[model samples]
Target: MTTQANVDTRISEPDAAQISEFLRDHPDFFDTHQDLLAELRLPHSSGKAVSLIERQVQVLREQNETLKSRLLELVNVARENDRLSGRMHQMTLDLLAASSLVGMLDALEDHLRNEFKADVIALHLPGLSETQLHESGAENLVVNETLKELLPTPLCEGKPQCGRLKQQQLDFLFKDQAAAIESTAVIPIGHHGQGGLLAIGSREVNRFNPCMGTLFLSHLGELLSRMLQKHTAG
Candidate 1:
């Protein structure tokens, strides 16, 4: 009842699976019939017919390349972390060495510009009184009694915030540079912002984003908080 066409159709690909299973079950079969290795011709991307052994080697080479790339990426990241760590240490020394509020601000601005690559820096110490500001020689220090009210919800609760901010918030922090800034980071200095707050602006849109880790920012805030309290206290 089966013609040549039907016979050919009946010979499905399942027989190949059976053959593969048989080969796997009897590894010695390949030892007995070493001639099969020469019959396996795999087409490569370069349009060349390669032997089965060569194909396996090529695949392994590709996997090795992928692993190497990943390892290189991790090494680069580690190097960057080390660089950031060194910069942070220098900043700590600068802040500690500051004799007055003006000196502290100067240290902060210099490090931010040279080490952190920040486009604009805004330090807000709304807790300080006008007399304190005058005495500390911080006439240019940004102060806002209602700064907490103007912040985003998370920042209001003393969270580190990053990414694109609303125009009003940008204007509040960076004033002249607000329009030029494409991204910003808002780091809370202390509880209720009694110490102060820091706003770091960048011209690049992706420079500051919500997904970035806040560990460094948190450390920066804590260090600044101690210095601010020391310098601003009566």
Candidate 2:
């Protein structure tokens, strides 16, 4: 028994000579076996370590894919937001460009044509009454054929004249023949007695709704009416 005990101890412990010889023969053997030696030395009660590691790797891969999808969605949404913001900025710039009555009308027509896509735009101003005109000079005011038909006979009996019959009350009309006209907004221009009207037509029915306030168009109309009054007076 004593001999057997001595033999077991000799097998378990490396002699100094044997250790030196092994190290000289394979210098990297210890490095290569370091992790394996450590794992072998640990208690087996730690459970299925390989299975746990594989499950962790799978969970990490799934999380990475989810994160990648979320990042892509964010990028797409940001691009769309930038596009819409740019369009809104351009519209604001166009609205600010209106200065004179003719310019305002041109701008409005352009907006309707380009943005709202209207079919036709028309403007009408009532004729002067017979009593206001000098009988001798009245014949000159009745030349406008369409105006002659629309106005009362008394207003156009003598000369063809552009008549201002009332305070800031200008009649405007817009017709969309294609039934493609989706929406219309009649904005009265000017303050008190100085303004005319702005009629906007759109090809989309829901484009204009009663819920929308008249602030922007009303201000534009007032500016235009003031310019028109100045032009007429001058």
Candidate 3:
């Protein structure tokens, strides 16, 4: 039989050993629990937060795309503007070139050839009043073969040739030669009282139409007239 004291001791002794072991492990276990609790309790972003960030990114992307499209439109407009500006600049140069005396005829000829592409150009000065073609003693006046033939007989008869020749008169004189001369622009090359005529010819029938703007030619004509007046008086 076991003694009572020994039985009690066995039960109490096991209980005391268990208490000591639990005390020894308590600090380490508490530290582990604290780390786990910290992990669980720490701030955790949900799917909603990620979704919000993605939405913001998408909005920014759309804004960037819109900006790029606007930028491209501006670039295209700028290029077109530049092209138009260049054309205008060239036209201005052509106009300026046609406003001088020597340069006027040269520019007019070039413009007609390069711009309007005319075939022939003739400048004519009718005799002044009291100045007979035969008696005026004006030689070395540039005349083509056709004009020489037309003016010779009437001029020998001592007819007065002052005053502007009517358009009808020009039409009558050149009517038969229409087949060879497709188009004609008879521009008066001076102020009303003292100017001569510039006859521009083109092989193309539609080159010198009535509807064409005469502003440039008119200014050039005035310059030519001034030059002629100076030369005649000198």
Model 2 segments more than 4 A misplaced: 1-104, 115-120, 126-172, 175-180, 192-194
Give the lowest summed-lDDT range of ten residues in model 2.
Answer: 159-168
Best by TM-score: 1
Tens-digit per-residue lDDT, 1-234, candidate 3? 899998998877757778779858685764656554433332224533333335556679999999999999999978966765565456447645543344444655565566556566555565443343333222223334564344432233222232223445445434444345666665555543135556666667676665655555565566556655654552
Q: Compose the digit string of candidate 2's lDDT tens values, residues 1-234.
A: 479889899889989999899979997875877764444432223554444335546679999999999999999878966764565355446545655435545665676566545544443322323532232111112224564354322224321112222221123143323243445555444432123334455555565666654444555455545544653453
Query: Ten residues in a row with the worst lDDT in model 3?
Result: 154-163
As a whole number from 0 to 100, the lDDT of residue 40 in candidate 2 is 43
| Candidate models: Cα lDDT each | 0.81, 0.48, 0.52
RMSD versus native structure for model 3: 29.6
lDDT of 2: 0.48
- Candidate closer to the true structure by TM-score (higher is better), 2 or 3: 3
lDDT of 3 at 222: 64
Q: Per-residue lDDT of 1-234 in model 1, one digit per residue for the tens?
A: 779998787776468779899878997986877797889899989999999889989999999999999999999989989999999999999999999877888898899988999998887666667776665433243434465567843346778889999999898778877999999998877764446678899999999999987888889998988998788778
Candidate number that wins on lDDT, 2 or 3: 3
Lowest-lDDT window of 10 residues in candidate 1?
136-145
TM-score, candidate 1, is 0.74
The lDDT leader among the candidates is 1
